[model samples]
Target: MNSLRKEPLGGGSSEPLPVAIIGNGPSGICLSYLLSGNTPYVKSHAVHPHPLLQRKLMETPGVSIMDQDLDYLSEGLEGRCESPVALLFDALLRPDTDFGGDMESVLTWKHEKERTVPHVVLGRNLPGGAWHSIDGSMVTLSQGQWMGLPDLQVKDWMRKKRRGLRNSRATAGDIAHYYRDYVTKKGLEHNFVSGAVVTAVKWEGLEPQDSGAQDSRPLFQVSGFLQNAQDPSPQPFILRARNLVLATGTYDSPARLGVPGESLPFVHHELAALEAAMRAGTVTPASEPVLIVGAGLSAADAVLYARHCNVPVIHAFRRSVDDPGLVFNQLPKMLYPEYHKVHQMMRDQSFLSPGPYEGYLSLPQHQLLLLKEDCQAVFRDPRGGQKAFGVSLVLVLIGSYPDLSFLPGGGALLTMDPSQPLSAKRNPIHVDPFTYQSTHQEGLYALGPLAGDNFVRFVQGGALAAASSLLRKETRKPP
Candidate 1:
């Protein structure tokens, strides 16, 4: 199981992997773990809050996650707009809140080399995926405990690195380092193709009759660029896969304001850029007030960072502070004090304040209409009065979606709505709850945010579901 089993093609080259994973984020990592012969088993006398689930696991001797009835475990536990399998997985892993309660895992890993599935994880970033790109100092929305993949705990990984973490509160840097380390530590680095940008994934029809591996033919032709670390130039490659899993996540593409000067040198899309500028002394107290746009958590993070650095900020957003739909309004004050402070500033119209929100101008229901040559941001307020603000930098943290341009018709075939482009924000891909396979296309599956399971804790379940489906299919195949 240490080496991926692959049949050689006519020219002494390896054939398409039996299963090809897109995006080596948590989803891909989880799949890599499960498919690499690390089978899961319910621990005997495991303490579970759900009696039915506990009994189900105990009654079935030597029950495995892949062989369990996932739908039965998911019933009455999932929300209206939640992945049921994810809920079941969370229950199995944590047995309570994702924050804490389960210091130990309720399951055990059993290595079975014969059950290993030949697969490759193709990702555009390092093993950690987009998490490595986030601002290191910035903390995650969810606690650190919710961020770890199966088998390896975040706290344990931190201990191995000799880092002292007193609580579940973890910085982005900690999570990022953990994910990158998890790959090598778990012996998954060999299967991962980092810095891979998949350009296209088209159905390439059945394999030739003379192929060596007879279980399944190459169903997908995956085309992407493999980036060179030293050269910075991309190396183009084409691959075929028997099964394609879309665990790509939706953080790659940043949603645009679609206005003038948005592409200007002063404007920025990600928080990482702003953090970089601050560290480089480009953004300081002497600099013009930074104009922060959007109504999401990222926008709030911008405000918090700017205010902490003593840099003035002009906050602009579409929704009012009182709007129930506003993300800030929904967040509890206790867990998210920094965000609550930003929300308070928006509600109180805190401008030129000297306290927590000093030099902060909160403009609710304001729109940025234009950005001038001299870093001037023209905005239309709620009263329809157009005001201009002189700012050093502009940040648009509106939101993001998965870039599915590689698929046909912008991946409309996999989405619930074929007329619209594939987007997790607009509509999650239509997938079977049990298998996580694309309802529209066979041998094509989705995991994580693509399948509407957006939380870090829920990612493992999606991979587990896909693994179960793949294994079941293999069992039924003719010898």
Candidate 2:
């Protein structure tokens, strides 16, 4: 498993190098696995193995995983793990189990490819990416089957661990463990370099042309700091690649509610404290109501966690109460009674009348004006009233956007569709849906949630699309 070596970064090489994969999350891991032409890990019950995809990947090589934190790769294995879907077991195996089943298959696949292109992974910890920071016990929004990467089946992993598979959803811990196992079982760990952070990605203009014509082929300069040394200071280095992949998903930058008092100690952007309370079974009712801002899954989780602790909830959102486009509508009410109940209670609230629920209050189309130190929230109420509500804690979960600040030129090198509405323009990095390559830049690419495929199940498509494009480019390169 430790066969893959981390090569030192040096210049002056004329050989084609591996594609630099930034952010070793599921998207990056899957891309690397596919690009390596390793056999997909299929379980015993896997049906309709993806022979087509296997054939596709077998032709491509030279891919690597890069990340700032590598510890995330194995974080899930350390705790109670779950996935939104049976990602590892069902989804990945359903369409193509043969491509990604076991070590023997992977070895055989490699031998068949003949010329194995060496790939290197750079990171500070494991390649779990954002999953490492997730709460181990937190259940995913989707079922377990939908959470698998392209090769590993989460359901199979759970089965091997002797964990119950009856539950539709898997925990965050389950996903982390699956990633770590995938890297080890697939023999990808050797290629991984711990303690590396990609700081800048610069697309150097084409080499000076003797013919006085602009060269279409661009050389990319990827600069980073490697912290593998015992010393605290990071060692700065750079690598040159033909292409660059940005798999750093949106979770890195959380959307903020830019109101006054948001910096206060009582305000929390995440539910770590609430999750801890639920795990401890500390249901002691709070004296003050907990304020939850936003309408997404995180806000809903906060409401549920607060209610589980018998703490009063004051849910606030900008969406109208009657908005059918809410995320809750996507869930099956029969299976998720709490979400259904909460939605119903919120819907019962009226502008003219009080809500039926005594302890829970839902405020729609209201903006948080300020969060006072004494657990007080000033709101620009939807009913044209400036109201102040008492609160012990504030959970703000409006949503998250991608942070491409690390990109050179502050995102101007990227492009957005001018035809897109003003609101959509806020997300500036537009890419070809089929290729995942930036519409503006030639060699730059984006994948995962950053590319707009928010769900885990669909993330594989982005990776596949990007890999396909890069492989095509590789084939086109002159010998």
Candidate 3:
């Protein structure tokens, strides 16, 4: 096995640091918690489930009702049924449990002996990343169960707090609060360094090996600025670790509409900015028929919020209403009646229209030309037709890309292929899908949306894959 070696840094201790996880979002929280080996509290008595509920849970996706009881299923059946939280808990927390398949050996290794490797998490705040930056009222597109970390079920947390049933969607604040609580419950708060922004991650190359021997292991120098509680200035610090995991998500850099006058005072990108304007009474209903760009979930949110404020909206999309795989087409109407209703209304052109092309205008393959001084938008039709529309405000809800600005060497270390379309250019870090280790850098790993696993429920798989890879590397003999 590879032994830990101490490296002297700026007069700091010579203790070897095994892992450093960047960003305290769900991915980082789950990885750090699992690495710490904190045992979850289990009830002494077996929980009995109602016959009807037991049968129902047995058919659930990630749930195996035989070993795990059904009483835990009732609290949040909606969310829990979709995520693998219960499966992960059973594998990692239960005594002598088999993780099964290829993971059986990797996960069981932790229980065979005590782990003493040191690890730390760096982030800007307790929640960190997009979860901390999002608006409080923003509800997730996925169910609450999908939001659970590896060890703690979001349903169990909600039940303990008497919040609500597990089937409901979680608000941004709800998810953020759960993450904070998870850190405290897992005793990971001591390992977390808040208000610390990792400015750069540099590869220190491979250690010098004996002649004719190959060394695949690489060292990483992680440097960042820690914000002082009292002082405005930040203190610089450096940390060296054997492995690095980046989970800083994709919401760091938002995509922009490259049009003239995009910097106008009335243009906004996020829904929070528009809500703030409404609260300040700066934007009024008289500024009717707000022009919204994009066709994703964020644009839908802007439309709903505008409707709530009694403001009319001109929903503009680049594709036709009959476009394949639209957000509305995929959403279950019964589960999201309000969203379905609003989407239908927009399609039927029921809302007030400020232009000639009805309420629902489809600018199929359209190109935005300019945003005029008088709050007018100029765009070209798919067939070389040009049109102008009047609007009080323009909400650009275009999606965001992953911001890997902190990675030194620009494209040298991680490059966006020029062959791919502009939208897919900011592709996530390239990693071995099964291991989640960087294809180019040996010791670097990525998780969460930053690694292209966008859904919360599915992100746990990436974490597991990464953790398993780290364990194998750490325990393997150099030979």
Candidate 4:
């Protein structure tokens, strides 16, 4: 769909202008879609980290990421924790090719030295998936899953038969393509600014830096670096907007598992030299007992990957899956906007699992830890005489937190709520409950996971919806 010049609002003038959307995840893309055709009074600009991906989006036809395989590859790459080693390994290992007849046994030997913990892998849904486009942007899709659970019911109902499921992977660029098509079709492509990273947001009407010179002028500075350009030094830019939305998603950095031997070169984060290790036949089950920390989606993915590779796997977490995290609200509330804004805001939230939780071929969190404790439990091939490989790699898939060092004037602009102790380290941005505006400063908004603390518990859909709703409100003209 193309953007059309429409009759001006109130039959006087054209729509004033569109608002700017400063992030390119699902939330941001979805936000752009919802705002299109809203009286043409406001438009949106989606600021994407990768611009070339957005450019390539313009060539495709109607919005559809139909190729499932490409979708998996994209997810594998983008979702890789620190690097693409795991994906590299998958690429190199051809199907039906044996690392060794005793490949499972070999993997056991490696686990004792380290632990391969459970982690989540996201992928796209099957054929004819919805396409995201904005303006001239369009994208193509291939077969694969994109960091979400495969929907068996949907497939079964449509095809009336189930096919053997293959592995899925993707990269940041790949997903960006899917979104490009999604937003473009919705005629919201102009709402994005690609290749830009928002650095800091200066609040208007805030106190002066020195306080010695007092002048009440509302101004804020935004610093960011440009991509795909020849500038050697970190190029800086600034912005002056009445409102700023921070949609930078979670996983600002890999959460390190603080334990003995964690700092050793042999140990690595989720994105460590996965390809090299796999190619060398080094990534495998433990010869000693393997211990996995954290029992969330990431841990689940790690276990599944290891299982697919024929390696014996173990899973662990401080809490059970049924009680994954603290539940924000069990049901919708009768009264809205009552009591503390944060508390009331959470009443309508719900939790949805993205992958297989517990079932055949999938061991429970407690079972995995028991194997670690007893040292005799073997995860794969129960009937075989193979011994348990001692633990080697300990993959900690428990959880992640944000590191706010990137923001300029850090502590002065945002700080942790003293009332919440568990989330103190996270230091989530405290935004105005009603408008999603930062409480400490004006013209600054916090959306998505960064703003979901205490109330929302970090879900993707709600964060994006809230941001879009608030932005529309800010730009909407009165009747």
Question: Which has the greatest lDDT?
Answer: 1
Tens-digit per-residue lDDT, 251-285, candidate 4: 54567655544555445456234324555766654
TM-scores for all candidates?
0.91, 0.76, 0.77, 0.47
Residue-level error in angstroms, candidate 2, position 182? 0.9
Task: Say what the RMSD of model 4 is.
Answer: 20.6
Cand. 2 Cα-lDDT: 0.64
lDDT computed for candidate 1: 0.80
Give the distance in Å from residue 407's predicted Cα in candidate 1 to where it truly belongs: 1.3
Model 3 — which ten-residue stretch has the worst lDDT?
A: 1-10
Q: What RMSD, rounded to one decimal, does every model reach?
A: 3.6, 8.8, 8.5, 20.6
Compose the digit string of candidate 2's lDDT tens values, residues 117-231.
3455555457777787787776777667667765446777889987654357777888777787888787677556556677787777674323675665676787777675466
Once superposed on the true structure, which residue ranges of model 1 sit more than 4 Å away at CA? 1-14, 79-81, 98-100, 164-167, 207-218, 279-282, 350-356, 475-479
Supply the TM-score for candidate 1.
0.91
| CA shift of 99, model 4, Å | 47
lDDT of 3 by residue, 1-479 (tens): 01111232221764436788887887787777656653222222322233433344445434222123323433333322222333343333322222222221112212222332357777777654478777767777877765777556677898898876323687887888898888887667767777777788888766533367776567788886777566677767787778989887767667898889889988888888778878888767776568888878888888878878877576777776667667888887766776776567556662233333233444445667889888898887667778888888888888987666677744235423434422222565666766677787778888776666676666665665666566555654221
TM-score of 4: 0.47
CA lDDT, candidate 2, residue 312: 82
Error of 1 at 327 (Å): 1.8
Candidate models: Cα lDDT each: 0.80, 0.64, 0.64, 0.36
lDDT by residue (142-253, candidate 1, tens digit) is: 7777888988888778788887553456788888889888898888877887777789989986865355766544478888777756756666777777789999899988
